[model samples]
Target: MGKTLALVVFAAALLSAQAPAKKTTAETPEARAARIHKQAIVVDTHIDTTMMLGRDGWDFMVRHQPESGENHVDLPRMREGGLDAAFFSIYMPGTVTGPEAVKRALILIDHVRRLTEQHPNEIALATTAAEVRAANKAGRIAALMGMEGGHMIDDSLAVLREYQRLGVRYLTLSHSVNTNWSDSSGDKPAHNGLTDFGKDVVRELNRLGVMVDISHVSDKTFWDAIETSKAPLVASHSSMRAISGHPRNMTDDMVRALGGKGGVVMINYSVGFLSNERYEAQQKNVPSAELPRVSWEKIVDHIDHAVKLVGPTHVGLGSDFDGTTVPDGMEDVSKLPKITAALLAKGYSEQDVKNILGENILRLLEQVEGVGRQLRAAASKSD
Candidate 1:
């Protein structure tokens, strides 16, 4: 009986050894997202970080929680969130005009440039798509500049040229109000779309390699600018109107047109733009006291809708951080990874996620730059 038992044990051991080891269970969605997020070159095209810096005298090198301070972005949080690049906005309120507008834009621009100069090892100012990649490879956050309103130019193409010379790569045609040349979504229509001068501004922006941003423009202005622009456009910080039903959000037709033109619509995280229900609830309250809660899932729904309207190549994250109240889970810039996880859970392919994260904007930047070079060469030949 002992011999028989020994033989059975040996047989069992041999069978176990011969059998292939059981494969490990598939990685959890969260784990998959984290891995993918780390590998991707995430970029936020619109952030009002400079506005906060100018207001609170906050240190860009130090990380501060939103509850502790009004600031939402800093070096440590960016690193923690794996954000590779960001466009620090030079935002001049629509009310500020004439020399005052120009002065405010200059001050904000200087502040952003100073941040990069102060943190050479952590961040570098990038003017081109290649420079952004280089900054990423160097393990630094690529800093880019975007002017939030065309009013900053004050009807002077010379001022626009100076802005480009100062490293402003994108210009949102209007802010919360209409400018002399362009109409804003937030204000009463003035130009009805874009004045002839508005079309001139688009041409000059294309020639100078500056992206024409239509985020705050009226529907007529959005269509007009895209039609006039020689290069791809960028709705730097807007969401889907189909979902949120806000004027601040782009309609499905606008998104489709933008995609056809090779432009991108970077979804905004502002609670008002993420959901109409939440926005209406907040507006109904006296003094806008309490806001209806919105989740990260709602933000993802906007992204998914944009992808469906226009392929994944025309969608990206703008965050609008520090400029507005974000959704519940996305209280600050550090919560960006949650977006990646959410997109993956929603069945987006790895490539689609990468495009939505940063690749799409990079391609747009390259194409815009190429058009600028061609226009410049033609002008020089004519001269």
Candidate 2:
């Protein structure tokens, strides 16, 4: 009888332990968001905060912790968003060209270097995949530079190499303006595509292990880049034109091609990149050419579309915050969690979401670095 009683007690104890515990409160939306966000490796590809640092005379670190104004990114906001890293654009304005544009690029590059020098603890200047990992381990944001226009080098491969040595990892090849070797999507008459020199630029970038970014190139130029580049390339801040119909956006074919090459198409969070209607709406109010371009919720929709088209591997985030106008809900970098929640609702797997947030970018970075290593080995053998 005593043995029977003890067995009953043991069973009772096991049952009690197995019972579902009651929550102190229901899992709040905020709490769930925090949990999911912590599991992701968030990356914003194209934040233009450097432009603010240069043009607006804004500080990047704590010395001037300005409120989140029209500006969409700050160091604190990045921490809040759990952003792993970002490509801080050293975007040269298209209006200035030749010597003036090169001079401007040099000055901006200096500004980026100074900012990194000033905030060693808060940010690290990354030029390779290894540096990105080291920066993440150091608990600081990995700040990498991407030259937004090929014009910045003034058609000089030597100048391009100089920028690369100075830590510029990717070159957009063109902004809104056509270069001596390539026509932009924004350029009229199209020039058919990349010139012979443009092809040389592609080869040179591959040789140097620098990424070829196709954000503002014409469709012909886009295909040419894909064909010429031995290494994978990225559209650091582009959206699906199938949804928005913007020439500045990538078509479904382009996204698929990028995926086929094992590259990433980071969705730009510009409202204009999201929907044709939103773009037309803004165009009416603002001049055709101006700063502070705005984006909206449809931005998430475009991201969703890219993922759907190319599965998850091809898509990632490039918010274009501070560099261009962002959408309404994503007013600042801290609001990145909202995108996470939206992505979750759309039924993306946690691994896929994490890849879209940052992993794919890391993969592309590694690929570029590998190409760089190979080129050097070949050159050494020749020597």
Candidate 3:
């Protein structure tokens, strides 16, 4: 009996030793998203926190909570969000115009530049796509600027040129109201899109390598500018009208046309832009504190819509941070990694997500710069 028991124990030990090792499980969606998001070069083309620089109790170095009413786009949250570059929107109210507009614009520009200067170790001002890439390689954030309203140019080509010299990259043709030249979507048509001078402005922007933004322009002006400009355009912070039904959002036709030109539509995160219901409620004097928050999924819906219409290469995140009310779970920039995960869950490949994150805008920048060089060379030849 003792010999039989010993034989059985030996057989069991042998069987255990011969068993194959356990198979490893495939990567989870969250894990894959985290890895891809970390490796990707993330860029948000617009944020409106430059005007908040130097305000009481607001510091870009410290991470802020949304409840504090402090502005977004701080260095800590930017790093947390894996954001490599962003275009700081230097915005003045649509009412501010003429020389006063120019003054406010300069002040805001100086504020952002000074902040970058003060944090050279953490961030650098990037004027070109190459500079943005270099800044990413150096493990620092790239800070770029865009003038939010055409009025900032003060109706002077000289002012526009000076702004370009000052490193202003894209010009949003109008704000809430029509500029002296270009008409706005928020107000009644004035010049019926772009005037003769408006077309000239688009040409100059092309020559200067400044991207023409159609975020607030009327449909006629948008069509006019798209036709007038030699390079691709950027709707820096707009959403899909089909889903949200906001007048400010772009129509499906607009996305198709813009994508045909190789342009991108960086989806906006403002609740107003994402949901017509919320916008109408807010407009009806409903207190925001009592209103339900807009879901973050709406951003992905818009992104998916644009991607399906124009492919993934023509989509990106604009956020419009610090400029308006963002959707839920996106109260701060640090939650940006969620965007990557959401896109993955929606069936976007890693490469597609990468393109939507930053590559598309970088390509747009390069194309804009290329168009400028070509136009300048042709002009020199004519001279």
- Name the regions of candidate 3 deviating beyond 4 angstroms: 1-25
Candidate 2 lDDT: 0.83
- Please give, for residues 87-132, the per-residue lDDT of candidate 1 as tens digits: 9999968899999999989999998888888889988999999999
RMSD of each: 4.7, 3.6, 5.3
Which portions of model 1 show Cα errors greater than 4 Å?
1-25, 55-57, 285-287
lDDT of 3 by residue, 347-380 (tens): 8899999999999999999999999999999999
TM-score of 3: 0.93
Candidate 2 per-residue lDDT, tens place, 1-383, comes to 99999999999999999999986878765676677777666777798887777756565653323253647777877887788788888886777788888888888788888877888998888888788888888887888899999988888999999989998999998899888888899887455688889999999999899999999999999999999998999999999898878899998999999989988999988777776876776667866565344445677788888887888887889888876656666777777888777777777776887888888898898898899889889999999
Worst ten-residue run, lDDT, model 1? Answer: 282-291
- Ranked by lDDT from best down, the candidates are 1, 3, 2
- Specify the poorest-scoring 10-residue window by lDDT in model 2: 61-70
Winner on lDDT between 1 and 2 is: 1
lDDT of each: 0.92, 0.83, 0.91
